[model samples]
Target: MKSSTRSLGARNAVLAVVLAIAGLAAQPAAAEERAKDLFGAEKLPTATAPQSFGFYSKGCFAGGVAIPMDGPTWQVMRPSRNRRWGHPAMIATIEQLSRDAAADGWPGLLIGDIAQPRGGPMLTGHASHQIGLDADIWLTPMPDRTMTRAQRETMSATLMVDEKTHLVKDALWTPRHTALLKRAASYPQVERILVNPGIKKKLCDTVKGDRTWLRKIRPFWGHDYHFHMRIGCQPGSPTCKAQEATPDDDGCGKPLAWWFTQEPWRPNKNPDAPKARDVMTMANLPKECRAVLDAPGPASAEAATYHGGAVPVAVAAPEPEAPSLPATTASGTAGLPSAVNAFTATPEVGVPVPRPRPPAK
Candidate 1:
């Protein structure tokens, strides 16, 4: 029996290697190139139509707008990442949240990764945030003065979790943190807020009554220093997809208990773990993304006009030209941001959806 099993395993291993080789042989060079560098692309495609396509991770965005690095109530934390770009609705929401944070105390807010200028998979770090709807806000309080660009790039987020106990480090964590979490959760447009399990536990223990907002404060891995905020599809873009809704429970009981158990921390026993993230191909993306990559650079003046003082204005900084495509209709551009200008030449294909007003207070 043992010999027979060994022979079967050997044959399977040989077959797997052959299949892997065949897969690579079949993929076109364009697909391979996309997997390597599309995510790391620095320049926004020439087209300035603000839109998101497909699901967040498997999708892309075009004509993305930049969130100002320094606002009245917030400072973007990581400038080098060049991830301050997002859909206009997301940008407006962040600005609103920053002011809300200031009203609650703590020297305004410290913001982190928004998305690449045209959203797609990141060059490194994070499997999500491909769409402009996700952002990271540091738990660390922003200082009352303007920070240098260098400071923004190098600063580390203040850790809140205890390594051994997997709980809030009692000394460093404070009630102010709880207050901030509450404020973020209260925003009507926000769909979910991801934090370390420790932070969720802290909320579970301290809060007295009325746990309605707690349902949105989801516990996820590796959010000790900052919380991740996600919004549903922007109103204007019909093709934007929403993630499945969270369960009805607050997630502080059985769901929370699972994270603390030995099972989650154990090494993967299955030798056949699926595949690495780097293996994703252009085929893995929505068909429209090819157009996103091929779209021409905007005219110099038009580019500058769109960016303005919103960001550093690298609009005229000389980007590599994308290879041209046979003319295709703008129908594929159905889902994206509102036009940069009501008069600019971006394709005017679909009607943008209007956002619903908040419930009466």
Candidate 2:
């Protein structure tokens, strides 16, 4: 019996490996087609359109949806220029989450924000939260669990929606918020997740016993306020590459194979320590949240050791040199912010900006 069981396990492992290779073999044209489709659309404005949809041949749809929550339905921020039409599978997931919430008699399952870009280029600047595929969801009690006021505060802080505009305020995590997050890890579309160090530790602990699915995902340092959820998006592909849940790098620099077998999730605490807050211009923030009277975003995720209590990150300046003003040129002024403008022969797409509004009382 033992020999037969061992053989069966070996066969299953082989099958899994074979399937993975086969999947890779089939990704090129599909990936190319996806790239073409993604880039072929209209010149992406600085951002994407509101709630566009993307459909993958493999049966996934991802885009914007306003899910009803405690008060109003949550509205996500979309890029002003480009929007990936969502696939059906993603749509079904949203519908099912709403249905499950309703049937379960919950207040509301608010999908506060999606695809709020924390970092990365090409898709950076102008508007990141603009990507329709990303989402920031509020942490709700597990259907079988209860939520406390502290948990609510943690959720509220973690959710960090602009009370006035209801877009993702920012992404950050704390110890309390981390516990709540482990409960939400079962969603199928989740690819890589970012969180505070303490939260990652708790996740490592909580899933130690049996959350095998957690193994398929990785974690990173998230800015305070919200957790960044990375989802898969590829239209016409039989399978989503980024969608396969995988093991985390255990940024703590330890092997985590025994993580599921351990008692409590013990994530690295040092790297997750809160750093001094960075000052951002109101112009850089989502327009809706600009109304926040005191918009100091949560503490930073990295620390600087100058030893002053929470000092602002210093900007290094160029070394002083003998000053020589630019020699006057015949027809141009030097060293002024360039007044560069693009003049397309045809009509061009312009990025949409949120009109500023008063802060919520």
Candidate 3:
């Protein structure tokens, strides 16, 4: 009887070992999971306090808020991508810009991608929007009528730059265009406004009077259809990494001249190499990001959407005072071209307009 019992106990131990190995084999290694795939799968923002971690290209953010798809002065493009989410300050800034741009004679704003709901490496396109501080505003003006979901996706943005000459097409360029960019650069929170090299050169050649605000307009590639606006790190995110400041001088000299050279447009020698997003795994991001991934999200996207007024103070710090402008342009009207109308009326729209939210008690 004792011999028989010993044999049965040995068999049970071997079975236990076999089961443990099977369990290990069933789970994929964390290091092998790509960060983009993990972040791209998220559909909503975390309900906790907002904070950004790591650099703009190599970070993640929590407590994101989505701007409504259809705002009174702006309409989000690419609705199917579900990329309108951003930090509360970013959303507020965009909303403010749209209203301000309208006052400056631009019809309305057609916003491009902001960031994924959670703000991390995307599955496709963009390398720096991971931190929720960057946004793309199409140079194309919002149409007079509300765009259908299908129209928003299919509409193509106007290309302002000539491919061969790398110059802004003179026919499409207008004084109002320059005024719009000027208004955008006036905000203190906006640290950088990246545009096509051609657009930068045009501004350098034409902008007269005080050119101080031109310091914030950066020249980069692939901005023919839209311009990129990047805000500085906010107060609540202790871990948020800030980008280097632009030089004090307007960047219209030697640096802007380089984009005109063939060196920048040269064909890639090794196009087959994988992009950083393709290989980045969870191990590559900040340790805090792991917790952000696991944090519970809101019940729906609407629950986390911004409805105007100030974002929670815990998430969005108070807006800094705008830098003082020259007395001549302090009213934001002195410099506009004669063609611009200060009081352009809002056109009729088919979409439902969002009602103003009551003031917080």
Candidate 4:
């Protein structure tokens, strides 16, 4: 009886250990998977009417069009990022920017992430761009030669700001960059342009006259490498929300000076100074987005779908690898729309966390 009791006790202990292991593993899949994590799992854009819904950070897009990989004057960067999708108006704006840049005697534009197809909170990289109305133009000029797929993946954007002085670096700064920015700002459709305060200062100090476009280029954090361009809402989409108008003045005075001071960059005194952006769920978004998220699409779609009788090609610079896995904290906390299942199924590994994208400046 004693021997039988010992054997039974050991069996029960083994069973308990197995159950504990199972429970521990299960926690990552369910508890850690938030709604934002699901955005990447959606391989296709919402196939309903073409519309952008909710504000920039909490919305989704339907019938998104892909900006093609190579345009006459623009080429995309980071093909594996799968962020080339945008509203058609936004795409057209980029196309125009490319043409304008060339006309200004500047190299072609090296475009960065615009929005994911079926944009919602992204797995990484942005708080906005959720509704497909924003884009990033690399400060680095597109090379005169056609970029190889591998070169596009590996090349780094030029940093324009100097670290010690918090000002523009002379070596990397140029008048043509100012010309490109002025061109982007001149577009009436543009709501704003976000750049490092240093870049804004350079513009304010250097541009000879006609400061009108300066109002559109507002100062923001961490955009020394690229300028973020946001346009007004798509013309007919009432669901789309327009950001507040840029203030009346050119914003080159006190407002611009404030960014270079200690206040903006001062370390948060709050012991818990870093707070996450408001957690977004489908519940927090427009009701129409529910159908957008669940909508079906063409199997061959590359973030583009058949909409309004045209199949816009989803353009990406060739990628050496597949899209990355959902980013996780050191403690294994995952950012969401469907962090769990997507992470589980992702073929790629060790995806770098994208730099934290600040909300609109």
Best by TM-score: 3
When summed lDDT is taken over every stretch of 10 residues in candidate 4, the lowest stretch is 338-347
TM-score of each predicted structure versus truth: 0.76, 0.34, 0.78, 0.74
Ranked by lDDT, top first: 3, 4, 1, 2
Candidate 1: stretches off by over 4 Å: 1-31, 45-47, 269-276, 297-361
Candidate 4 residues lying further than 4 Å off, grouped into runs, are: 1-33, 270-278, 302-361
Comparing 2 and 3 by lDDT, which wins?
A: 3
Best by lDDT: 3
Model 2: lDDT equals 0.33
Residue-by-residue lDDT tens digits, candidate 2, 1-361 = 9999999999999999999999999786344422222222323111111112211111112112222222222222232322222222232344444444444444334344432211111222222233234444444323333444344334443343333332233353233344334433455554446543444454555445555545533543342344555445422222222333354444333543333333334555686663211222223323222111111111221111111111223221223332221222224433211111111111232222222222345
Candidate 2: 10-residue stretch with minimal lDDT: 337-346
* Higher-scoring candidate on lDDT, 1 or 2: 1
lDDT of 1 by residue, 237-268 (tens): 55677777766678789889888887667777
RMSD of each: 7.8, 23.9, 13.6, 12.2
**Model 3 lDDT, residue 327, Cα:** 16
Q: Residue 101 in candidate 3 has what lDDT?
A: 91
